[model samples]
Target: MDVSAETLIKLYVTMQRIRLFEERVADLVSKGEITTPCHLYTGQEAVATGICASLRNDDYVFSTHRSHGHYIAKGGDLRKLMAEIYCKSTGCSKGRGGSMHITSAEKGLPGSSAIVAGTIPIAVGAALRLSAVGGDGVSVAFFGDGAVCEGAFYEALNFASLKKLPVIFVCENNLFSTHMPVEDSLANPIIYKIAEAFKLPSCRIDGNDVLKVYKTGQAAIERARKRKGPSFIECMTYRWRGHVGPNYDVDKGIRTQKELDRWMAKDPIKALEKMLIAKRFLTNGEASKIVTGIEREIDGAVAFAKKSPYPPSDEMEIIRYLFR
Candidate 1:
């Protein structure tokens, strides 16, 4: 797996940015500054960073509720994203859509939905439209393991396979959907097998390893661009934070502390750093400098969001009328 030094550095920087951003968001949520229900993408940073690195600026990405990492990795503006979470007028959605509904058409992120599996069909539709126009850009749908149980998941996969649409289905299998473990929820528990059943090219990779994810995503994207049809990529990863909050969910007794510690030990950011240092791609001092820069960027975004004002009361009514 030969990757350029520049690409590897970019991947590391992107992952760091996501980690800092999510950590800041979690702090804000704890302080009640960010009132929105934010699903922090703390430990699953590598999946988004690796996958989005393979995408062009024009390639579309449909995201799930845990969308901040996807948005940031896909080149979304940090200030606008933070402002959106703060429900300010300068937000990406003009404060209309909060954390779960961030969208940036300019960045090729059409939108994300709060409802599980809601964006699957939307991504398939977008792929169909792209196919009709003979566009070379591929569309990607980022969903979780829980969505596989939904009818929309099967339906979207079936249609994409049937039409050979240029779309990539990325399932971030974090082992749990909300509080329910995969064992309790899924009868089979293996998601990639379902994609195999659809006769689509599919593979499961270690989502924590950015290199593995990047290589696999590159292949999937290439297949889609070649019009070889949709591909399913199951990324086996874990989320460090609770299902919906900033705290660990061990208190709820759904997951054991031992289980959480085991996953935490495989922290993607540290793993990448270790690999980079080992390969002479980056020095410890250089990595520290990179992290410091990202922290400053995150701080600036937080300050920007804080200074931005909320939308006027009348503006909400006008938006409602327009949408209606």
Candidate 2:
């Protein structure tokens, strides 16, 4: 795919937003403003941005715990995302979901959950609806490498294939399931190949390279839109922070500093910026302006979250949501 200058810039901007947003959330969580556990999506921004670039506003998106990147890339409101993490009423999930359970109906992001492989089945259900009702829009499920171990993943793939539903299963393989290395957890460490057993077209791509991810994602999404059933894209990426919390997981020797550094060197944002600058698609001045703009947006989101009131704590008021 010949990616244009505008697309490249857009991808860069989206990745920057995800990176900055996650970084800001980490800072807030560190200061105790956010009381809940947050699984930061620090390093894997490319997978979401690249894939989401192919989706329409009406296309469905289901996300896992490390969901901030996906939500932002899918066009969910930044203020709502920040406020939700702050447990404020203005949040997309009405402050009920916090960081891990964010949702945005208007953006086609129904919800994200902390449970392993929880949203995969729901994404399949959405795709089934799209197939039955007749539409080209596909449902996408964004999950970690750990999700492949879940039975729901296998079942979802089977059903999606059996009925020829339009769903793209995107596995962000960051090489670790929480603290444990992916190699130790799965019988077969190769993730994308697993979809082959279910007769779905799948492949592994470099998650750090946004352009590659976008091209491959476009193919998978087009396949689903063509009613060719599900396609699995295992993007090999890495997360910079701990399994849960603001701190890096290296303190307990969960992963060596050297290993972390190696992945950090391949930072998606940095890589894209370098490519854009080298290609003369982006100048140094524009790069600085882009960063400045993104930082200002992040500042605005933080202020909104800080001022937003927390959801009503009264028993009756809380129960009202259950009825709705």
Q: Considering every candidate listed, which one attains the maximal TM-score?
A: 2
lDDT of 2 at 102: 92
| CA deviation > 4 Å runs, candidate 2 | none
For residues 179-291, write the lDDT of model 1, one tens digit per residue: 99998888888899989999989888999999999999999999999998999999999999999979999999989999999999999999989888999999999999998
Q: Which ranges of candidate 1 are over 4 A from the true structure?
A: 315-324
Compose the digit string of candidate 2's lDDT tens values, residues 165-256. 89999999999898889999999989877898898888999999999999999999999999987898999999999999888889898999
lDDT of 2 at 315: 100
lDDT of 2 at 261: 94
**lDDT score of model 2?**
0.91
Best by lDDT: 1
The collision pairs in model 2 are none
Candidate 1 overall lDDT versus native: 0.94
